[model samples]
Target chain A: MAFEDKLSMILTIGILTSSALMLIGIAAILIQGGAAGHSIKSLIAANTTVNTRTLTLQDAFSGLSGITAIYLGIMVLASLPVLTVAALLTRYIGRKDNLFIAISATVLFDMLVAIFLIPYLLH
Target chain B: MLLLLLVAAGVLAGFIGAITGLGGGVVVVPFLALYLGVPIAYATGTSLISTIATSTGSARSYIKERIANMHIGVSLEIGTTLGAITGSLIAAEVYALHLQYIIYILFGLVLFGSSYFSIRKLKMKNFVPGKADWSTKLFRLNGSFIDEATKKKINYHGRRWLLGLAIMFIAGMLSGLLGIGSGVLKVLAMDSAMTLPIKVTTTTSDFMIGVTAATSSGIYWERGFLQPLLIAPVVLGVLVGARLGSKYLVKLNSRVVRYLFIVVLIVLGSQMLLRGLGVF
Candidate 1:
């Protein structure tokens, strides 16, 4: 299969999924982003005034506290495109290169580094 | 309440950002620092990681389109990858310590500049053939992408290998230093300088940023900045959001989106600068 043809079929599924749920997903994300933005703003204000309280160790981890909830919510949205486009492209290209495979490897490399470093940085 | 809100911000940023190629940074970063209580450095690093995820996710579409031009993307990346290593080192040694404000200002400026370039492209003529620069002509940098709108082949003569390589170098530096994906610069190089249509430029630029970020993420990991738990979900969000956004982009009014993108960049840039300088 030519790359273009393969892509068309895969995108059909993607377009369907996106059309079905884009708005709902968008709304959910908006609310989440607004909250994170607001919390940090208040913290900055509180910290600056009177120089009363410096940021604590827990302060750093606060950003990721919401990661799981936000991640899961967004993952459904993310999966749609990857499945649609990637599948489509695979069909179109006929020959698959190791490009994405390399990317997956690099991502793993990134994860491993993070795994080691986050602990050291926090301490 | 605040934590709940931050979670919401992450999700929303993911939602709108993928469409805009922002990956929730413009919205999430400011909100994290000003509203959610996250520190600026933490916010910046997190935003950078998410931006890479968004780009990686979106690469699927570009690959599908074949506009990503993997040959060009991978080749020019040599420069971008090198630039990333250098910039990260500089940021850690010099900017991270004594001249923090300088770093903020520089990154903010890069943002505004790239935004302006994007906006300028919106006003530029649609795919009029321009004479390729001598450099582009030499390397056969000129190629065309299918303009789905006009349903016509848009051909151009422009600087290819060197121009992209140079632009990627600058883009990589900013990516490492300030935490932006620098797709804006990469896109501008192709759109304005190389004369590719916006879709090709945008998609290819997104295609390229992943590798650039990968380089930095490695160092950031070894030096201990990456947090798997923190990055995992965000990457998940970014991938999904960017993929959807890229797919739907074919339907949206890109001119309108371009302006919106510029405005967001300006807003984010100013916010970061002010906060970093303690003027916020």
Candidate 2:
């Protein structure tokens, strides 16, 4: 398959998976009337104290609660572009296209630093 | 009830954005901040996350159609990602200092500026590619795409990579600062500066925005701006609405729609500006 086709497939699968997880989260919230001990009303409030900074990945994966599912869904969505760039890097490396490999590597490194390193440093 | 309202707002923003080509962030940020009374930081953060949805959705098709120049998009991303990092940090500082009014004013200005360009672009003629410079050869900034309207293979090459890169950096900064895709500026860099074919420019812009937005959204996420309840509904609604709008775009009298949306942009921009000025 062509590179574009592979990319298209990855995006399709990634979006579908994320959307499904989010919907499942909404459903769980509605059915349970809350998530992680917070009421739905509180969770939906603009000034709600629950957010990424207060929640850990381990907490999100501890159970399939509404908030946790939504958190995981968002994590998946945010990682889609990184996954695409990684795929591109792998392809370029296979072809020994050093220039594109360097470019892709730089972009991937930037994303990783922003997602992981900066947050770690700031906190 | 709030969730439903948020979803409706997302749908409207995404639908308007797709049909007018102004992008969903333009609509999402203003409506959330001004109407829904969400904090500016949270509003922009939500818009940024939803932008990833629309970008990825559209870019998938563009890539398959082979109109998007991956070579150009990937190379320019170096500048955009770096700019996004700087912009996100600036936004963090601004929010921390309780100067959200700055973001409101800047977003309003961007809306006004992009509206003007949208109208001007309607009257612009096709680009005539100039001589390839050194940056073009070094970056391999050239590609060909089959035009659907003309059914002809149109070859195009980009020149002045440094200028394009510089503009892309600014575009990325605006994107992070305002939680927008800044597609208008990206188009400006590629269409006006790099002199690429419009098809190539637009598609590649779509392809690049996801990464640019992802860069900033990551930082926003860490800052606790990405509330799950707010983002989930908006992202889902935008993804669905953008898909519907793109399907109906050919049937709609887009010129009429564009003019209507331009009017909406002016109104929203002015409202945001006034709000920032404490007129409300």
Candidate 3:
């Protein structure tokens, strides 16, 4: 397959898998009366105030089997773009396209800074 | 039930966004914040996540159809990503100062501004680039795509990379600050300033938005705005809707999409403005 085809395949697969996980997690949450001990009503309330500050990574991982499946699903969704960019980088490297490599690298660097460095700097 | 509501809204937003190549963040933010009573911050966070899903999902078909110009998209991302970081930092400051109303107001203005331009440019004529300069030759900013509407092969090249880069920087900053895909601004930059075809511009912007949104999302996550329960359904709904929407885009007339976009922008813009002014 060509590069664009491969890239599209990667994106489709990533989105489909993550979306399925999220759907399962959301269904579980609704059926199980919410995740991490919150009731479904509270969890789904229009004005509910759940956020990253209120929810921890550890909390998300621990509750996936029980209630944190949604968090895990979102985690997958968030990471997929970065993964796709990485795929682009690898493709460029194989083709020896310096311009694309630089471009993809810069974007990846920006993503990394946001993911790891920014949070560390803030706290 | 509320989760279901979110999914339903996401579906509508995604459908419109994918067909128009606007990425749906524009709709999701206003729908959630103004209509659904979700806090604006959370609405933006959820919208950004959904933006990623829609962009990524729709981008697949756009790429396959060869409507997206990867050269242009990748070249422009450098400015956007850097601008996103700067914008997110500024956003953090704005949020800290409890001046989130500014975001609301700015969002309204951007929507209005872009809608006006889109409406003006809604004439179904294809844009013709005048000449390729040094920047075009340096970047090799040329490609071809089959226009589904005309069913003709459209050969195109973009020029004025400097202007496009500058506009994209602003677009990125807006994306980060407002937690939107900022596809309107990006498309305007490419379509008008860089003189790329509207279809190519829109699809390339769609292809580019996911990276920009993802870059800013990390900050959103750390800031405690990314709520998983809120995002899960939006992501799922948007991805599915965008896929369906992209399929239909091939058959739909460009003018029809622009008209719909104009209506959505005006309604959402007015509402956000009212909310910002405390009129509602």
B34-148 in candidate 3: lDDT tens per residue?
8788887888889888988988988888887778888898889888888888888888888888997998999999999999999878763756775998888888799987777
Relative to the unseen true structure, what is the C-alpha lDDT of residue A65 in candidate 3, on a scale of 0 to 100? Answer: 46
List TM-score per model, in order: 0.66, 0.93, 0.96
Q: How does each model score on lDDT?
A: 0.55, 0.82, 0.84
Worst 10 residues of 3 chain B by lDDT: B121-130
Q: In model 1, which runs have C-alpha deviations exceeding 4 angstroms?
A: A1-123, B1-7, B12-17, B20-28, B94-99, B133-144
Docking class for candidate 1? incorrect
Error of 2 at B73 (Å): 0.5
Number of clashes in model 3? 1
Which candidate number has the best TM-score? 3
Give the Cα-based TM-score of candidate 2 against the true structure: 0.93
Rank candidates by DockQ, best first. Answer: 2, 3, 1
B54-146 in candidate 2: lDDT tens per residue?
777777777887878888999999989998898999998999999999998887787788678768755755557978999888999998877
Clashing pairs in 2: none
lDDT of 1 by residue, B25-139 (tens): 5665566566666545555555666665566556656676776665445545656666766666666565346676665677567767878777666766556655656566444
Ranking by lDDT: 3, 2, 1
Chain A TM-score for predicted structure 2: 0.92
